[model samples]
Target: MLSRRHFTAALALATGLSVSGLALPALAQTDIKLTLDWRFEGPAAGFLLAQDNGYFADEGLNVTIDVGNGSVEAIPRVATGAYQLGFGDINSLIKFLDEDPSQPVKAVMMVYDKPVFSVVGRRSLGITEDPKSLEGKKLGAPPPDGAFAQWPAFKEVAGIDDSAITLESIGFPVREPMLASGDVDGVFGFAFSVILNLKANGVPEDDIVPLLFADHGLNLYGNAIMVNEAFAEENPEAVKGFLRALAKGFADAVADPGAGAAAVLARNEILDINTETERLEMANEMNIKTPYVVENGFGGIDEARLAASIETLKISMGLQGNVTAADIFDAQFLPPAEERMLP
Candidate 1:
């Protein structure tokens, strides 16, 4: 019993339309709920910017991005179809699929070309920017943290003997504070995040030392955009369109990080723009704008490297050989290379 105008408006709303003042041609809209690997900090700018800039709408997608607790947690959410898409660690996703090959999720775009996993420690506690320094130290690690999950493989690659190391299963909230109090000598977390947080906690820059796993013989990919298999199967074009929009969003973020930070600030009012801007810049320089990404464009990975990573995971993560690189990633949804280049 709706009028023509009312019906049109309702259709638009149901299809995830961002209503403007003018009338426009009606098109079908697909709803996509995306769960991020962490809070709405600077790293989340690319996804947030795409949504705020109407790139998703341009692709006929009504994308709802939700904040998450951890990258590994996003896997089960996507696998269970609770979220149609997610951003998470591809390493964990590989293990998840190895446990059950039929999980309804697969990584579509590589976000962090360099893994954010690092061992952040204090110089006063005798920790250095060397992996061996961790051998006899007390380290705080959150069990669910993505970086902590890398230890089994990280220790193997870096040849760190844990016999003398003591581990504390601390919660995420207390990680920096504990380190600041010198209750723990070091912690496992993203280098940029941990370094900035330690500084925020009154730790001096000269006292902080970060030893990244990637720089210490771990050649693994990091977080990525993944989609639920069922949803992607039902809407392949929507999947493709989503990736395309994301590429545009990342490109825009790379071009103007301030704008990207503003988008994140819109979602999280409590965060400082300058800090968020710096965090965004770190992610851009350390992860998103790697030499490979800059040279080859963004959102795609080399198949050979992925295969090699899987082989490494077998030793580091104890994979049962149930999954392959192709099983974990599907690159067909990515846009053309030239279209994904950073400005």
Candidate 2:
């Protein structure tokens, strides 16, 4: 007794047709932009993995990772909405806060807690045993943009005359050669990038001792995850999604280094990644050594740690009259331990 029209429509409805009642499937993931602290290299393993393994997509995000010239530009770029997120140092962030309190930036997660900067010195220069030995020695360092700007605090803590050391303005590429050929006593450099590479090149570790900035009162976060006030407020879900994917990437990198190195290499083919041992070591250091990065957990910011960094930044950067940590940083985006899934 069913008419042809009714029969066909009833069959369509029974066959899972759109009966004007059921909801449609969810849409695809959203896209996001993230910036890195340094050029594309092995250090950016976690970020590379997140993109390669579709972690961001899994979290409903499409991530675009941009290479940063340095922390100086990257942090402010994020703070000003040039990018949605940034990875860099706490010192730069503190400096920015001091310069302009209006453009407050907050770290959503920590990456490297340990200070990577160090004073690379030759043993022949009588720079041995500890930082105190560097007193009265002709110490060399990279230019103002280099780590030397933070050396004042270290020198003070080490009991060396602020003027006892001669800080040469040799750029980054010249650091190793200047020290090797005896053009200078040693150089200040990022431990992982310069010092570690030197060691890997058959240079004896004892030949060059790294006076870590952290040991000499230069404790600050390195390679942190930060965002601007506006982006953080308007697009919190996007920020959270990016962080979530990054957290998984970090966890994966620490858990399996072989895969991590591959992830890094995939992002930047120019990296001299031939040394497997060095690459693994770098990954481990980034994950475990830094204070900002949690033990057995994702990166989380600590107020006490931030307070310490604030004081260090003020003294180290000679910004006593310039800025405060509270001026530049906001703690709101800093997810709690529960959110970080810390063990």
Candidate 3:
């Protein structure tokens, strides 16, 4: 468990480095294991690209990247010390903190700054233009994760009746097919997963309409690097080294989106249901949207963004009753990367 004072001290130290020109001394080699948000896909490609390209080793670290079952599972696994770090959404992290403030899970890095979950419907529904058009239509949703919980806001922002849209728990898989075949008027899909699958099945982009949560008001940072609080406390230096190398990997992904897509395909043994072109496009989109690459440079966190997410989770997902941003994340492990000459 991390003390509140300890986190504040770390945040102060982390704030000392300028985003544009921060760097660190070369670190001694160490072994670190990371868990992913899900199985190999364009979304999880950056880690694969970094590992395959020797980015981690170059940073004087040897990392093992494990596939994850889901973001919900990913957070607790890291917090409980099953793994050093895991990829997750801010909502999941907040929920974990709510369950146990003293638990070790803390988000040290932001991966996706923009929320990726979206609602898809046919243009013929007239609901495509305005969110309210779906008044009497059924809206397909998954469980109580970020996507499901945020649907009401997704409808509210569009002036649609919150109750008008029926909540159908479609689970994670089979959501894309459910939307395409008209089994459901609309379903929840991420920019990378749902859109990719639809386009692959020859669903013309114009024929489909997406109501992304980011476009609405659900602006929680998604897909972050979470580490066990205990591990981060005991091995702050190791955590710092991990971020330094990860930033490099992210920069590489942004610089060469095509290579990044290839790395994902190779890692998974095949591309996702989407076409190669769509996969590449999704990769670049997700890369730029990642807060690790956007808000405060790669692998950094924006306190304001985090604060907004904390409120959203509490109001929308019924997360821990009174969790604060400080309770869910610690930025101290992130040193200024500009000064460090990463490998």
Best by lDDT: 1
When sorted by lDDT, best at the front, the candidate numbers are 1, 3, 2
Q: What ranges in model 2 sit over 4 Å off?
A: 1-29, 138-140, 144-146, 200-202, 270-277, 286-296, 320-331, 334-343
- Candidate 3, residues 215-248, lDDT tens digits: the string is 7666767777888878887888778878776766
Tens-digit lDDT track of model 2 for 254-289: 666677777777666665665533655674564344
TM-score of each: 0.92, 0.81, 0.81
Ten contiguous residues minimizing lDDT sum, candidate 1: 17-26
Residue range 1-343, candidate 1, lDDT tens digits: 9998888878776775645665554576899999999899888999988998899999999999999988899999999999999999999999999999987899999999999999899999999878999998999998878999899999999999999999999988999999999999999998878988898899999999999999999999999999999999999999999999999899888889999999999989998898888999999999999999989999999999999999999988999999988999999898999989988
Residue range with the least summed lDDT across 10 consecutive positions in model 2: 287-296
Cα lDDT for residue 292, candidate 3: 51
- Candidate 3 lDDT (Cα, whole model)? 0.69
Give every collision pair in model 3: 22-337, 22-338, 22-339, 23-339, 23-340, 24-340, 104-229, 113-291, 292-298, 292-299
TM-score, cand. 1 vs. native: 0.92
lDDT of 2 at 189: 64
- Least accurate stretch of 10 residues (summed lDDT) in model 3? 17-26
Model 1 clash pairs are none
lDDT of 1 at 227: 93
